[model samples]
Target: MQVNTRSDVGGKAEAMDYTKEAIADPVVERSFRGHKGMVTTAAFSPSMKQLASGAKDGVVMVWNFRPQLRAFRYANSKSSSRSPAGKEAASPVHKVSFSPKGDIVASGGADKAIRLWVPNVVGDCSTLKAHTGAVRDVDFGDGGATLLSASDDKTVKLWDLKKQKFLQTFNGHVNWVRSAKFAPGGAYAASGGDDKTVLVWDMQQKKSVKALKHHTARVNTVAFFPSGNLLAAASDDKSINVWDLRTFELLQHYDVGSVVNEIDVHPTGDFIISAQDDATVKIWDAREGRLFYKLHGHEGKVQTAQFSPHGDFFTTGGGDGQVMVWETKFDRSIASIKKKMAMKEKKAGSNLEEAKPEEVDAKIEEETEAEVEAEVKADAKHEGVGERVQAKKVSISEPAEDAEREVEEAPSSITREPEVNENYTEAAKEEVRPKTAPSASPANPSSSLPSTSVSGEQVMSALGTIVNQMNSLMEVVGRFDMRLETLERRMDALEK
Candidate 1:
């Protein structure tokens, strides 16, 4: 379909150099199955209320995009009648196009005939015949007063629809012409063919203007960007190429990795869809030249894809003989923009000043340290309370003599501290270590002590145990901090 229009030739622009966002997940809204053979081509009406599809069975079907919007549909338009000589009357169809006003559905097929069907009413279709070879593609001009068709005749032809007469034929390709499109004002036309070339023609002059021969194989589809400044083509060479129309210079190349059968640019020039032989439909961001999503419902090679005129949805037909409709999900576009914005903010740029790296590191370190300290203090308080309750119970019930017994009962509690206290008690009993001890000046006048009075050395040793436990907590916090830093770095790298 033609991308450029009278107004909004200036469409949604994106920065091709920017970082790409994550691909979107696919969502199929509807599926229509009736064709007994490969569905070759499909197109959305300008109104988007109906969809027109043509298949190899020589049938054209018009379907309601939405169940609520009722319109006449031709579920099977192929004639079942056979000739007396036992020959099939119907010919394989290759392409279908909707008029600008959504009033007529035009289909071209192997019969070398273009049939115009009034899809909103039950009526006979009218045929317009001129080409001697099978028609491959057809499109309506700006005002729907004219039509363009590419065919196996090795030429692109323009016809006056209002007069129902052939206007002109531009010949250049030595092989079948596959696709044709009109520029913004319909003054110029572009066509791609099996000759591995894309040609731009001045329709008024009836001569070729630019010849793009970069494709290594048959060119399958071609389209002009909305502004008429760029044109894109897809080929069996497994690539899609964009050219600057003004300079006729190659601007971008996308290695699709599979034979591309058909490609269409969105009306806003923001997205493009490629139907590939891998049974996949690839959606790409036009400005960034990035593959945004891959749809995987068709069981056979996907042959045709086109966007709705409003750009909110698209439809695809495949060799499986089914057409699937999918919504683009505008919310995902906003999310992608937000993600790209975040990437820009994080990246170091001359125009965007960033905080000093050292300053950020120091700030994070300080916060982590504070949090660790608070957690350590809370653990110490809880530990002290449990210790005091255990000590009181031991003093009242079993006495200090059974402290070793209590330790044996709860082996999980206080393993090292009890052994240190035992060693100090043994030293006091021997009296050999008394000389290094402090003098007992506090017991000179008023002394209140039980039979077992703990020495000052034991208290110092217990305080050292608490310091050791705090160090262990700090090590645990350090490990956690390192892990968080690693995670943040990975996320930053992906965004860039």
Candidate 2:
């Protein structure tokens, strides 16, 4: 994944140091670091003026979004030397929501309580606690007249916002309900839970209108498309399943590499975004069902992904303790530029190929030697373990008999390699078997080693044990590689 981090300094005035891709990186931006635990959710105000985030710490922060966007805009400019500040550094908030007018903000937390705040006010807040368990999700209904909340108690409750009274409790899910979202029209809301079921409730009737049970694992999140005609679901089954609202029939199915924690459709319904356990937020073309591009940059699982009401930008809240804002950018002439660069590299490669084979081989040898030297230096600095473990884990290439033969031929070299620890070599030596066994006495050469050799039987047992251990180690290694690659890709994206 080659990223072009080169930002253009001579172009548009509104352009800041931030690229649309920068929004995808988890690094590069050091702001919004207050959350002490993994952030579980985030939402942007309808006006795009405020951002709300919630974390495992049972705290949520509602900050001014405009300044952060501007700071990113000026991050690469000569004026970027100035320090940046935020509107609010802390809040006693958990899950947050903005009213239709983007005035009042509502937050739910582990305290089994919900709080509403009037932003920028001296002392204005209303607290409500009706659920018996921590609230997992919250959303405002049509015109902010109603509020929907789901909890670990396995119930979804509708509340009258003005009266601050619980209106109804809908219960059908057999387990803890993890998420709930009001449909675009507020006529309905969808709830998903550990029971691997999604219940669509008709707000007016106060009953489930549909029960979707397609996921093989726990359902994580659900959302209604802009038209309110379709629903997108993310589940522990490691898939995103879209369903039609009119017929209540399953529609498209897309597999993300790991647990899909959250899914949101763009306001325009042209794209969809998924937050996954792999620490990646991926964007997909909704209508065409094609991957647009993967947005990388979260050090931990992406807890939530949402698009702004205007469809110009999207926000992501990550377990890494930060929120990111991504927007669209136009690449006017990237195709022409890449074509020219490709031709230049091709011409240079052809010119170099005309050299003598020995010289070319020597150059190749020199590069290889340089690589080996760097590897040795890196090993001396303690960078050998991770890559080596990853190599052994992935093992895309088969284990080489040549290396085993070389180890057999020069046992001392294997033991002397500076890259391997002394204890490891000693362990290998203890495990190695001699190529040939000692002969019996001349009178009975066939019975030299043992009367009835059990060594072969023992060797087979040891081989089986080793094979089992290797299989277990490979599984562990595969998980590590997936996680590490995900992290690196995210950091690289942030750096870009």
Candidate 3:
């Protein structure tokens, strides 16, 4: 039997007029409605025959898209057994994701727990409780054996699906972690957070390998390209950054004109889609960094958008509590226009002057120097001694003049505390003093005195040296104390 791969849009168009008419009108095949609250997230199953949605009502609904639209509630057996007539989450659900094999689904939310469910099942849901704060997003690894979750607790945790046990916790973001996704092949995972940074974690090493810093506001979402050679980060700064994974360099930057809530890359690796706070979804040509389309239909902010597995359709969920599905139709006219635009850009680039190698190196060096100077100035103005110490540590690799300047501008308290501590001298003297008395001799009358008294000058010199070393050690301890205090405050807040 011959397989039918034709899309819902039919085939290529012959004229631009036909293409324009087709693109202007999008057919909504079906609208699935059951959630009592706003649908915060939605995803298509691996087979594209089902859809899973999560809402603020703390409920997850799975819809069968084939034959007819039927809804199924995913709830824990414990909760169902207690109240069989009711169906609702204990807290708001934030995210829902399907496993690679389509046999399982994971949902996490404000309850600070990840619940696993099998579609069409009424009860017996397994819950994984580890995060201290609201869980923002969850993603399955390539083989579906592991899962990654981002949480407001400022951590991204990895879990083993079979054992249902926590594997590792990635902690570096200073603010809430909003999104996490495993890279292709599952060797690395990328996470974005309210700290305005994107961290790439090495799964095997269990550590963050690279930090991508460009977003000026909270990084709301992150997605890796199909090839995993590039990673995209969307932020509240109204910009999306595409980073080259191999070199850890910024490849392209596209401004979406509003806060981006979520982002997804096309399976074809040719386009990227972003749901914006401005009640619109924007599509961009991923390779060229150019806007491709602006889809507008939602009455409120678009919260999430995703493409289907077959690449024939896409879905968008909004704050208005509506989910709209659109058909993906690539007509000949659209392709021709993109091709011409690419050629035009290539032709125009020859007239531009490109920077030489030396100029590029000089520019990088200048930027580095400016950043260091700004940090030093900021640290000097702040009253926190820990900040100044951190600045000093960062400037250790700078030129002698710069280091000396940092020391001169450092706060008087940090510089004088070591000198005021008399314990260092006393401790050194006590440690160096001998227990036995010296034998008296005719040639050496001074030997009759106690070691502490006879060698007072030597002891004083040793004390001074010990004091200097202790002062250095104290600086390190101060930094550690500052970090410890911050962690204590976080834990206390979580407890409350």
Candidate 4:
């Protein structure tokens, strides 16, 4: 079936599609909406049942990848039994991912924290806080047992999910680390950072394997094909280069004619998807080194694109706040051959019982400990957000109140005390009040409510209405007084 994809501005999300040419096919099956900010990145789970997206609003939302309505829950919102998935509103999440074997997910953000999430759960799976700057990317390693995070702090952190402690920091990147990933074999991991270099690290040795440096500008993304033999790096220099993983040698270089934001190899190893600032996503024949399809529709920069695990569909997220899923015309002829090749690559005479029950228990205990540590970090974050929000509100409403209170108390410099006060205030309220914006209703004497610090802005904006109502009440009172005096004079005359 031919799929048609088109984008239009200021229309309902469903109604925006129109064919650019009469002969073109519609490419989108359905689009889902949930994130309140620009979707920075998205990935399909290995099972293809779920879609995860990270946004600048600090939210990492997981959506059902069904062709019909894909329901999602916000992470920080109240739980509803009717929703297909629960919300764990971790906002401003720069990246989100699912483990290869389980429903667990890892999300990293500008907050310099990494959070792991499990499906049907209400909160984070585990929280790792080691980076001092924004975490640029995160991924699962060692069959989702280990978590790897890259950050602007110029280091990549390896977290032991079982031990619930930071394993080690891969510290060779001279600039901010942009992306990292475990090779499909799980023996080594690759990281690309702002130093215009890619470093491969061996897990057992816990050191750098090789540093691949060729791009003249910052490397934005790096990916290893499922084969783990080929590495592709996208960069700000408008090029995508293929390299041999073992030798770290550049094999093929292709100019994308724009800043390449992300690169992904198809699971079958035949096609490559490169998202670019040119507002188009290009599919290339990875082997032939030629462009196959140029998918153009996004009105803004295309941030990232990936093929579904099944290879039948692909999705793209852009700066326009759109996530689009497209069907492909490619057949399964390549994938079937690769599957046969994979079966042959298994090592001969390996012990099948290497994984034991005790080992599994140990991993669970470690992840549990990591989860506990994450809970403490989340609580601290909740407190920090509350304080910042309160301070912003107080400043916007009446900073003088705090200043006056401070002067009256003759306290030490407020320091971060505003945050402490926010905690106390929330504890006293002990009620989750539904957040409200200023009401749109007009002000009148009949409905006159005294202006509190919170209502000052609303009261000022509606001051004219309040004044008119007060004038009307004064006029009524004036007539009542005159009528009372006249009646008293008439009674006195009658008495005489």
Candidate 5:
């Protein structure tokens, strides 16, 4: 099932260059195999030397990626040893993420609590609890001073990492918030949810400023590009939507023909990798809005895929209880350079073989240079194609013709009807209120009442007003109850 890279040979060469064969495909460099249950999520540290993974068994394991000091699992106590089988049960962990410095790791899951651990520490240093339902995802802020968690309770909460306390809660999605991530500079946060909407929140204002609705099904993941101005979202609708964060405009829509579970943008900002339910990962050229390569390896739904900080490698976790590390072919170019230098040295020491060492070295150098030159030429070709693709404005145009063509050519099972707008009307929008104190009522309420004319529009408007008032009252009540609960917890802490 491997594709041959020899077909795209470059210029004529005196000897057959085997370097191309060495880096033909993105072969698996390693497979992590300790999780007793499905690996729910995995992420590489900023240094790319360590990997943190969370599994259904609630174990958060950090691997050094080297053989000697292999891995350490966080337990309930101050010990890194494996928990006894008959001891306290472990909760299923849904997400694990490393902070920007890679010094801290966060995990959250079915326990409805978020725990923070230092990489080499034995147990969690702190725990934050607020979500009422299963926590679906967790992410660290830019400076690692704050953390964000998404939960099935339909809210995303920001926590102060230093204080280990809840700071603020964002409520916008009407359904479970599946994923939340801090923008590059941490000025804003983006969240996607079962409401089929992507929300960009103003962290300083503590409110949602923009809501981007495009997906037909639940949005599973949202990621901000490295520049922080482009945001990408993947969904169960079999499409990936790229938006310009500054303008909130849809920049590109790639219909992947399968349910996209997750997506990671390369650090170069030129490519995107999407893991799909079809057990395949597709790399797309961001500038061209076209497929660059397809990686096939996973056996079941690929739940997660992440590019290393340096973009030299990428990892994927699947439902089949496998985590695979893949080496990008682009990384091989650098290896080839080193290999070429070594070949020259080897040829110099091989005069006893009866071949002219200098000639052999010259021929090998020529072949190596030719191979590298060929790669450069191929890159130029891709760039030229990208320029042409951009010139056509395929990614920027509304109702992209190229995307439509892809959809038409796709199999029937992969194609579906386009999404229809289902946003609430103006009146319905007014019916929902922010979770804050209610305003004082007017003194002269009779003066605000409409005249006795009873048209259908008037009746509907009156009903909407009543609903809005009810919503405000309910929000007030809920806030009061939450305040009481907070007070109770504080009193208990004081007593302890």
Candidate 6:
């Protein structure tokens, strides 16, 4: 099953921070339209070379990621029940999923059957039939040899694809099961249904282990975070719930205005994408729930949204029968994501030190000098991220000239409150928003993921340097103060 996997750009290099750039004018890079009816689902192959989409017209189409290549589609023939599975659209294909191996594609629809096809080779396919009603969704296991499926028959079924056998029926939902997916580790499975509940199943036992009853309406889809411990469920009730499997804790709950049809966490687990009834696909920061972008291209309601295996691209299926591909620019590939993070760290390091506090020029006066010495000693004695500045004792007999210089500098000591505050605020903002890594700070380089703060090491290092300089000035001040006291004592004794 060989298919063209070429890009239209033809192997040219792009900016390393391509995705970090501001959102493009036209959010959809390419739109693939072949379905006569609404699109139900879209999925990217593990290799990211192909995309498989299912439509309400019953066609399961496989396309090269490039727009130039034609799509290869297979559908069920309605004329004959025994006709070759390589036919035409007979009923709506509600969901399509690519196997982990990227070699096989699974699709389920109103036909009450799930089909596995090697998309590149149209006729080479098999069907697994057990659901008594329409099949709603299908997902591949971690190894791709097993599958989990939800159906209108009010059950989620597990299948052994290698043997083409029905493994077990996970029956807990009292209504139609809409979606089901295997955990990243394959230790558990989750399902959402019209029953208004999300069920977590222990894969080994093939039974529901926990139930989340929060959605006031139907649970449209369920997906597991890459870690396999966090489960996210979208609902017709206009909300998305993320819960931790270990502690059954509600980690995040978002009241999205539109009914969320489906949600997928990025491969990096830093962002989440949602398909909504508002015809908008939203990208969100998984940690903070911050909305990054509300992509608008679909003419009708969006039905399914998924991040590519690499997180560089995402696909959306809409009621307009169009499948849109989005370039996120933020690639989740280990090397690329790591490089992006490294660049962010470097930028933050630069910004944090960009506005360093200049040397604090203090006026030399009796009161001000005393205050300066006391403050310097206090800072020197403290153990902190700042370097331990040590104050040295000066010999009272050392030099009259040095004492005179100390007296001269005393008048220069004035509180630099205004200037210090100016740098403090800028550094503080940079300290809090490291992900913005505003290299204009090129005016604001924000990340789609949760923001990071500047490291304390750099800030402390700067403060340590300032403290060291202040401590040096303190040694001379002590000597000058002793000289004045000695002169006063001699003058008083002579007068007596």
Q: How does candidate 3 score on lDDT?
A: 0.74
Residue 394's lDDT within candidate 5 is 14
How many residue pairs clash in all the candidates, one count each? 0, 6, 0, 24, 0, 12
Candidate 5 stretches with Cα past 4 Å from truth are 1-24, 75-89, 331-496
Among all candidates shown, the one with the greatest TM-score:
6
lDDT of 4 by residue, 200-241 (tens): 888889999898888888999998888999989889989898
lDDT by residue (1-496, candidate 3, tens digit) is 1211212231211211222323432335666777777778999899887888887766788888776546787642222222245643347788999999988889988878999988865635788989999899999995899999999999999999999999899999999999999999999999999999999999999999999999999999999999999999999999999999999999999977999999999887888889999987777777667776666667788888888876567788878777667775642335566777789898766432364434443544455445554544454345232333233332223454664454455433233233335465566646554565455243666634445544677667776766755565455445533433443343344335
Query: What's model 4's lDDT at 180?
Result: 90
Tens-digit lDDT track for model 2 on 116-168?
A: 76755342678777998877788899799889998888999989989999989
Q: How well is each residue in 1-496 modelled by candidate 1, as lDDT tens digits?
A: 1121111111121222223443334467788887888999998888877888888877788888677755454533444567578866567788999999988888888878888888865846778888989889999996899999999999898989888889998899899999999988998889999999999999889999989999999999998888888899999999999999889999989998899999988877877789999988877877777875666678889999988887677888989999888776643564578877778777846323365554444555456545544554555456542121111112212233473354344323322233444565665445323233355434443333322356677666666765765564454344444544543563355346
lDDT of each: 0.74, 0.66, 0.74, 0.67, 0.73, 0.74
Which ranges of candidate 2 are over 4 A from the true structure? 1-31, 66-94, 121-123, 330-496
Q: Poorest 10 consecutive residues of model 4 by lDDT?
A: 388-397
Candidate 4's TM-score reads 0.59
Give the TM-score comparing model 6 with the true structure, all chains together: 0.65
TM-score, every prediction: 0.62, 0.56, 0.61, 0.59, 0.61, 0.65
Model 3: per-residue Cα lDDT at residue 216: 99
lDDT assessment of candidate 6: 0.74
The total of clashing pairs for model 5 equals: 0
Quote the positional error of residue 107 for candidate 5 in Å: 0.7
Better of 4 and 5 by lDDT: 5
